[model samples]
Target: MVGQPSAYIIKKLIHDVETVVGKVLEDRSTEAAFWHPDRRARR
Candidate 1:
């Protein structure tokens, strides 16, 4: 790990966080946890 540059590690972390946030945003079911109406059931 020490062999990796700081910029590369930061970029990887940002990419991973974006991937997860994008996925979670795309899925409507997750809304129920914050609000009501599990809209994912419709699809």
Candidate 2:
């Protein structure tokens, strides 16, 4: 296979992408919970 990535490379790429996406989702949810005006009103 010319120019094809190995299985390890593909797995690493997928893992890296999932880590980044998970972090982004976690940050967004944390920010929304902390700063949403409607949620703040309940306090």
Candidate 3:
């Protein structure tokens, strides 16, 4: 917070945050697909 963050540090932080966000989004999409009405209607 006090000093400027290096490029490497910033990239790492961004990568970590994106990875977590991607995982959450992927999970939600998978859950939605699993529960989609069309899927149930097809059965």
Query: Which candidate leads in lDDT?
Result: 2
Candidate 3 ranges with C-alpha deviation above 4 Å: 1-5, 30-43
List, residue by residue over 1-43, the lDDT tens digit for candidate 2: 3476697788889999989876776679766566565775677
Higher-TM-score candidate of 1 and 3: 1
- Lowest summed lDDT over 10 consecutive residues: which window, candidate 2? 32-41
User: Where's the lowest-lDDT run of ten residues in candidate 1?
Assistant: 32-41
Residue by residue across 1-43, what tens digits does model 3's lDDT show?
Answer: 3375687799889999989876776678766456575764666
Query: How far out, in Å, is residue 32 in model 2?
Result: 9.2
Query: Candidates 1 and 2: which is better by lDDT?
Result: 2
Task: Show model 2 residue runs off by greater than 4 Å.
Answer: 1-5, 30-43
lDDT tens digits by residue: candidate 1, 1-43: 5787997889999999989876786685566445534554554
lDDT of 2: 0.74
TM-score of 3: 0.53
| Clash statistics: count for each candidate | 0, 0, 0
